[model samples]
Target: MAKDDTGRLHVTVKTGGKRKLSSKLWLERQLNDPYVAKAKREGYRSRAAYKLKEMDDKYKLLKPGMAVIDLGAAPGGWSQIAARKVGSAEGKGKVVAIDLLEMPEIPGVAFAQLDFLAEDALHRLREMLGGGADMVMSDMAPNTTGHRTTDQLRILGLVEDAAAFACEVLKPGGSFLAKVFQSGADAALLAQLKRDFTTVRHVKPAASRQDSSERYLLATGFRRASAVL
Candidate 1:
């Protein structure tokens, strides 16, 4: 291991018998990432936890007693943070999460192993919450196919679906946050969010890698009465 400019030991991985170049590089990056180590130390599920933490700290997206929904939540990083922020453990808040994969139980989070894009998803979430949500968040991304345009479209599609769900599930004056990439949200999506929300913007938190194109689309102050489909 050699120290980088920040004096942090950089762990390097050598190409081995079965490991592909991409896998090797990914392992090396994970080993050397400070956020990964910090996540381990702090008992968080994943490094992506910091992304939501940083954004919520700055934007005040979460509040105690709020009802929140997490789309595509797995391994439960963001749900963990939201549960804490909303005091879900104390029964003062509620957090409902849905993902295609199974997730271990979290103290204050209700999880469903269901696909968010499924037709029954919105109904399931509403049943779980028993009411409208104060906030909806999604950190979902489609598997990349090495085609930039295709990847961008996939990312935007997921965000758009999440946004639509948010619009239907959130209470008046609620908020929505979802992951977007490349140049952030598409113009049409942004315009629609602006019509439904009081403010719409994109934020790239420090926890997101410098070279990464990931950005979070945040829309706050839902106006239920004037919202259009």
Candidate 2:
């Protein structure tokens, strides 16, 4: 089970299978949740994998031999999808994932359980990549308070950091994908991305719950900024 933005444990099961009201409700939802059934049939860790897949499909960002970095990657859901799409390490694709929480090892992918906010974390990620990355993905969300503004700011900080790091390390044609709450990313952030990328858009996949404020920022075509020596 995973916690939602409000620290509520979310479980996927057939709500119609039990007599209790809550159980029946939950089970019915699970039974009807296309993503849940798809995940189970496809052997994925969580239904969230489909979100990335949908995004990538629309943007055509993932490929068979690209280097990728996954921030806040846990339970290996997105990592698994990345690994499969990027091909094996020997074949030119590699994925390096990091989070403050420990995650089980996934074959053909590398992981580091460390806080991204910690000192030298970005440097460590660069070292892991060995070279620049073709894609940087983040599903990071800060610990939420009951206050909406507070939560939005915290999450915005994460996306800002991710975007900065990506600009520093992404290749000229690379892409960045990040999760953000709807209406959370400010104009400043969008302007910054527009300066560095050829294309920038916000996307909300159908798999995401309609009631949730979550959305994603999809940026493509990294532009090499001129440097002064």
Candidate 3:
């Protein structure tokens, strides 16, 4: 394989091979993915870093020394980026990241291994934070069922849970960012975010595959229910 100017591999599918067409296509795309190349160069865990990087660049959410919570932070990509942007957990800035899979420790991030929707997860997260967070980001997506409607509902559930958790833990003027399939962020979730936030918008970062329906719902300015309602 040869690399292009962007560092992405120049790969092509062969006519005949033991690999199926799907497998060949997947391999070709992975080899050609710009985010994958950029991730390797940047030492980030996953290409997902570009998603957050793009989002942060657009929203100006991350700041040094801010307290942050990262839900579904697996492989530590977002956490790695957050650590550099938000400082270390033991430092003036704190980042608490939780995921079902264990992520290697990042210098400025505190990792918790558990299910975000588990019985004690929220309690433990709060204990770890010691107070409300300045920003809450969740890239959580449910394992797809292949059935479009089912998959959409499942992902939407994760987004809703993440949003509710953010509402509970985010300080006023805080921000919430979560991943959702384009069709999954229903009216209720959008309304809820709008009710609690000054700005609620859906964004599809360039890092996401063009064929994918996934996007991020970015909500800023948390207006606590007690204050607004």
Candidate 4:
């Protein structure tokens, strides 16, 4: 590790033997990323915690006593922030998270290891929350095949499914946030969100890597399910 002219610590990963160039680059990036360091220092599960924290700071999405649902919540970074902001740790709110991968326990989060797209997933999440949630958020991304169009389509599909579940599980005036790629393929999803929500906008928090194509669709003030139906 050495300091760059900007005084930022830089980590160099020697490339050789079993380490592929891509793997070496990824490791070097992780080692030098300030947010990764900060996350470790702050006891957050991942650097992604800063993304939610920054978004919530700007939007005031998570509140004390709110019921939150975190979809694709593996690694439990976003769940951790939600649990703290919603006072779940103090028994003042509720947080339920679902992912296909197993995550270690977070103090205030109820974790379910199941695919969010499964037929029974929504039912199971509803059972866990015992009622509608004040907010539904998803940072889920599909596995990339290095094909941009294919990856974008997969991401959009995930976002659509997450939006559909959010509509069913969110209370009136609730909020939804999901990750999306930079492609303009989300017109249909945005149209549906605009119809179901009072406000819909794109958010790219500073914590999101500047080079990443990832952006968030933030929808708030949900219409009641009855009204939508």
Candidate 5:
């Protein structure tokens, strides 16, 4: 471990035969990230937990007894935070999560191994939620294609679908938060959000990597579904 200019100890990963430069760099970044270390120390699943924690601190999105739906909740980091904040463990609230990959059980979360984009997904999620959700949050990210424009479009499409699902399941005055990239496609989604929500804004939590273009679109006070029609 070597100390960087910021006085934080940075771990360097040595690249060799099978280890690609990109893999080495990513490993080094994870080793040196303070949030990664903190997450391990706190027993959280991943460093991504801090992103939701920070956002909830600022926005007060989670409340006891509120129902929450998590999209693309893999590895269960965000679901863990939501479960605790909403008191799902004590049955004060409910947290239902869906992802294409299977996730290990989180004490207070109900996980479904299904793609959120599937035709039957919304209906299944609504059944799991049991009723309209108080909040819908997503941390879904597309597999990078190495092409900047293509990657951005994919991210936009994922967020748009998440937003549309949020509209379908969220109760009046509910909230929606989803991960998005810094790209032109966000404008269209923002316009739709403005029409359906009382307030819509973008947030970049401190836990997100400084070099990353990722940000979250937070829309709150959702108008009744009839209002949009």
Candidate 6:
């Protein structure tokens, strides 16, 4: 093992043992990732929990008793933070976690195994939240093809759809946050967000790896009357 630039010992993986180079590299990175270790100690499900935690810490998002929606919430990492911060576990707030995949229960998150892109999904969430939401957060990503251009299109398409959903359910003055990558959202989406919300910006939490191009697109102060919804 050798130390990384951070002076943490880098655990090297062997090339053999039927492990593909890609898989071996991924395992080694996970083993050495500080966020991964911290998540375990803090009883969080994934390293992503810290990303939301850091942003919320700085932005003062997720106030108690707010009705929150979590899209692409599988593994339920973001849901856990939302529930705790909003006091959902104590029954003072509401958190709905929606995902294509199912995970074990979190203390206060109401999990929905449904596609947020589906026609009925928005209606279902609206009904659950009594037609208004204080915040919406997404950690969704599309299944990537090996082709870079195709993958980028898929990612942007997903972000656009998520933004549309946020515009619909969010109350006036509500907020939206989503995970984005590469060059971030497309121009049209960015324009749409700026029009529909009072402020739109990109944020990269310290918990996110510096080597990764990933970041978060955050839009706050929804203008419900100006939104297409």
Candidate number achieving the greatest lDDT relative to the actual structure: 4
How high is the lDDT of residue 150 in model 5? 95
Predicted candidate 3 versus true structure: per-residue lDDT over 95-125, tens digit per residue: 9999888888888788899887788887788
Instruction: In candidate 6, list every pair of residues with a backbone clash.
Output: none
**TM-score of each model, paired residue for residue:** 0.96, 0.82, 0.89, 0.97, 0.96, 0.94
Pairing residues by index, what is the TM-score of model 5?
0.96
What is the per-residue lDDT of model 4 for residues 80-139, given as tens digits with 9 covering 90 to 100?
999999999999999999898999999999999998778988788888988788999999
* Residues 1-229, model 1: lDDT tens digits: 8999998888889997999999999999999888999999998999999999999999998999999999999989999999999999999999998998999999999999998778888888888888889999999999999998889999998888999888888998999999999664398899989999999988999999998888899999999683322
Candidate 1 root-mean-square deviation in Å? 1.8
lDDT of 5 by residue, 1-229 (tens): 7889999777889878899999999898888889999999998999999999999999899999989999899888999999999999999999998988899999989999998878998788788878788899999999999899999999898888898888888888999999988887678789999999999999999999989999999999999555221
Steric clashes per prediction? 0, 6, 1, 0, 0, 0
Name the lDDT of candidate 5: 0.90
In order, the Cα lDDT scores of the candidates are 0.91, 0.83, 0.86, 0.92, 0.90, 0.89
The pairs that clash in candidate 1 are: none
Off by over 4 Å in 3: 1-9, 13-20, 226-229
lDDT of 2: 0.83
RMSD for each of the candidates: 1.8, 6.6, 3.0, 1.5, 1.7, 1.8
* Superposed model 4: Cα runs more than 4 Å off: 227-229
Per-residue lDDT of 51-161 in model 2, one digit per residue for the tens? Answer: 998888887888988889998898778998899899855566889999888898887788988877678876787788777789999987888796998888888888999
